[model samples]
Target: MSELTCFKAYDIRGKLGTELDTSIAYRIGCAYAQVINPTKVVVGEDVRATSNEIKNAFAQGLMDMGVDVLDIGLCGTEEIYFATKFLGISGGAMITASHNPIDYNGLKLVREDSKPVSNDTGLLDIKLSAEKNDFTFADVKGTMSVVDTTKEYIEHLIGYVAIDTLKPMRIVVNGGNGAAAPTLDRLEVAFKQKNIPIEFIKMNHEPDSTFPNGIPNPLLHEQQAVTGDQVKAHKADLGIAWDGDFDRCFLWDSDGRFIEGYYIVGLLAEAFLLKNPGASIIHDPRLLWNTIDIVEQNGGKAIQSQTGHAYIKEIMRKEDAVYGGEMSAHHYFKDFAYCDSGMIPWLLVVDLLSRRSTDLQTLVSKRMTAYPSPGEINRKVADADVAIVAVRAKFEADSIAIDTTDGVSLSFEQWRFNLRKSNTEPVVRLNLETRGDAVLMQAKTDEILAILDAHA
Candidate 1:
């Protein structure tokens, strides 16, 4: 058996046909069943053109191992997580490449109760078993069944916000030709059924596997313009966009100004703390000061964890945190079995907007001005470690505090920045925040880039 390159640190991903194909996906399914040895498993797929073929092949492999498969067709990654926990299933897998390009695909796996399977957990074992490609068949093959959890999932989402309290606000939603369109449609119908007067100005609101408007990654500046334009053209109250699998959602204010994910973290922390004061909120180390201030000001505890969904979820469960957020737009909720959701964050934000009777700009602008951040900037270098070490060495003498939690974080009296290597890509990411000094932020960002450039 040949080695498979699709296995990654947290999940399985690779270019289609070359690095991954139906055969490899089948082997992975068989290997997962062999390693976990579960009686039943759930499966889901995104809107990619090849997803159905890959998912069907994987399910066949599981069935050959006597593992009954509950096929939840055409859904996001979080849906699989929800079904795994809600249905009392032993395991689940979602076939998606997330924000990756059109030519790529992968699988995100979880065990019982929707617990993630990272490299340190069960992914490596699954990879090794798949590489061996030798498995014993069960006495009897298991059966396959189809199930739809759309209504239940929508109901669960509506539970987050009071229907009557939602004002008749016009909001723009850009699905970007991904899986979010279907889910958004379902939510819209549910709101109407409940007599909610919210109006949805839909844009690119269809599941086109071809990605006619390009991929749904709103993180890129180019991909953000369409949503911003729509928001402005419709003169909507707010704007929201999602990735291909709809696991992460981005926001725009009433003026069509993009809100950095860092501020959204602070906003969400405040929202949760309003209801449950003294609760714990988990955040990543990349961008800290804003989140720390918001969490502390609300009489809540702020805990910093390493980046990545697996780490955040684990820390949230341990600390019993009400919420956890990453600057990269991933948000986790304790009520959602410690798993991250794209749907829940937007729902909670809309609720906050309605309850406050304030526009999105007013809700977050103060926090943004108090703690200005350059969001996350990325630089490609020959060696990320060398660049990180150089930055730490140069700043250690003047830094008030230094932390190596996930990367190198140096804090001074007024400002701080974190330099870390991207886990899934070959680049170094930098995040800097200052105490109401945009000039100082830009100057320091330039200095750090010079150091990184020297290494490059």
Candidate 2:
């Protein structure tokens, strides 16, 4: 069997025409049918230009294998997860490359009950089968049906926040000209039907496959001003933006200042603890002092896992976590089949505003001061392993404790940092945080960068 470069550690993603095309997509669909062997599978596509053709070819492959296809047209990734469980389907696949460049595309696959299909969980098998391309068509071809799960998804999201607890507030929403607008529009209608007094001022709300306003990748922090300026201009209480598929969201405070995803993890952890005391909360190893403090003070438990969706979701299932937040802006919920949702986080955050009657900055500023972090910084090196080893050697002598759970995390009396290599690149990521010391955090961050530079 030949190797497929499109198959990645978590999902199938690659450049559009070269690494992934209609032919490869067909093979992948047939392979998925062969490996998963599901009778009925749910399929959906984002707003990418190539998504429709690729999804159709994929559906044909499933049909040839006698697996019925239920198509949910034009949706975000979480919709696939929701439909997979909501419709009682055997499996589901979403055609999206969430936050990837304009010319890239890929698929996020999940099996029954919305469990992820990653490297160890049947993705590699699917990749190998696709490479072989030896599957046969069944005697009776499967049929295709278009389904609507919007109402069900909206109702489920509404279940997370109480309407009476909501206060009159204005919010700025930037759809990133991707797939988030449709869902947001529907949610506005639902909120109106329920008489919720929240006003939504939308930016880049229209869906455009060309991505005229650039891709909706709020995590990159490049377009933070686009949403932040609007929030301040409109005098809105909060600002929210989503990536292409609306799976991960980024936040901004009232003064239009960007709030790092690291702090959002802590904020969300505290929110979950306030409602469900002593609930297990899952967090990534990077930039987690704030999260730990919040969980502990609020009478909850904090569990750290590797920094990836598959890793976090597996731990969510194992621990039955009430909520899980990553520094990369991914938030997972037990109520949503342990899947991450971009929409749920904002709803809960706004609900927090209503309950506390305070602004976003006021809520996060104290935690931001108590445990200052510069967020994750990436450094490209000739050899990532050498760089990591070099840094560990320099810090281990003075470190009070060290952790290699996912990476080398060295803790001092006042400051701590986690240095880990990237899965898809020859780069090392540094996440450093200090206990109520922003100046020391910056100094340590600069020191680590200098060491990484020397090693490079």
TM agreement with the true structure for every prediction: 0.98, 0.98
Off by over 4 Å in 2: none
Candidate 1 wrong stretches, greater than 4 Å: none
The residue-by-residue lDDT of candidate 1 on 317-397, one tens digit each, is: 999999999999999999888999999998888989889988899978998888898889999888898888898988989
So what's the TM-score on candidate 2? 0.98
- Per-candidate RMSD vs. true structure? 1.0, 1.0
Tens-digit per-residue lDDT, 119-189, candidate 2:
88999999999999999889999999999999999999998787998998898999998899999999999
